[model samples]
Target: MQKFLFELNRNADFQSRYLSDRRDAMNGFDLSDEERHALAEPDIGLLFHLGVNGQILMHFAAFHEIEWQDYLQQMRDGIAAHGPVREGVYAVTGYEGVDAHSSRLSKTSDAEKGS
Candidate 1:
């Protein structure tokens, strides 16, 4: 989990770009049925990416630039009220250098850890 979080920290710029594209599609733009389905599916990795992405995009769209501090607070609030960004995922805090609820864990590891 921490590894994925570190990966996100390093690739924040790329993630921002992805968020921009996703926002465009969500805002009355066209997408193929499959693409729409992909977004709709309950994939934790996708949701995490989207949540981070959407926070940045929404900040820009709503405020004309990234207000990350506020965006983070808003994202946190939204997640708390609604639960995890997607099924089988959660919003974790206090884990250093990691994405909370990282989906990188394998089934074997989960079994070993009894998670």
Candidate 2:
């Protein structure tokens, strides 16, 4: 799926096919049903949750005419709806997620320490 996005970003002909018919543009790719659905349905948020690189996903969103702010919000909404990225560079290890991370920061802040 990542490769497909990269190709779609680089190739004008492929971009045309995607604009005309997303399923057909995706013909040769061995994408999972979730991947295919996200692409075909043009779900920007779902794709983010599926772990697509932002650089590649940004181009894909542009093809769909999604505005920049909307694209960023969709990715944020995807994380809220589907949890953190399931894979890719954004995936964190054992550390807790955003809420916990923020709480930890507050706990150690100078204000919280009365400094």
Candidate 3:
């Protein structure tokens, strides 16, 4: 994942090569079908859910012209529509069982009651 992002960002030659022949460029990497599909679709939400680092993802989003707000919304939508992050640092166990917004609201309510 990091390698793919790096190639997109750091290697102009790779970019040119990929632009000319996507399959040929992709063949150079060892990637899963899911990873390949995500890249092919440029599924930012899925990539984020898959735990691509924010720093890397931010640039990728910028390259795709996704605004900051839109990028965030896409992540939230991904969670709502697809379920919790499947892997990586952002993975959460209970996300599948509750609405994140409602969970936050419940916490806020508890805090208010205690106060």
Clash count, one per candidate? 0, 0, 0
Predicted candidate 1, C-alpha RMSD: 12.0
Q: Write the per-residue lDDT of candidate 3 for residues 1-115, one digit (tens) a residue.
A: 7688877877888778766765667886888888877776678877877767768888878877889999888777766666677776566543443366688889999999999
Task: Estimate, for each residue in 1-115, the C-alpha lDDT of model 1 and write its tens digit.
Answer: 2222233345767346545664333334354453344343323233343343453334332433435566456556545554555421232432221244354455557888996
Residue pairs with clashing backbones, model 2: none
Give lDDT for model 3: 0.75
**Which should have the higher TM-score, number 2 or number 3?**
2
Worst-scoring 10-residue span by lDDT in model 2: 90-99
**In candidate 3, how many Å is residue 3 off?**
2.0
lDDT of each: 0.42, 0.87, 0.75
Deviation from truth (RMSD, Å), model 2: 2.9
Worst 10 residues of 1 by lDDT: 88-97
Q: What lDDT would candidate 1 get against the real structure? A: 0.42
Candidate 2's residue-wise lDDT over 7-29, tens digit each?
99999998888888889899989
Give the lDDT ranking, best first: 2, 3, 1
Residue 115 lDDT, candidate 1, scale 0-100: 61
Which candidate gets the maximum TM-score versus the true structure? 2
Q: Candidate 1, clashing residue pairs?
A: none
> What local lDDT does model 3 show for residue 36?
79
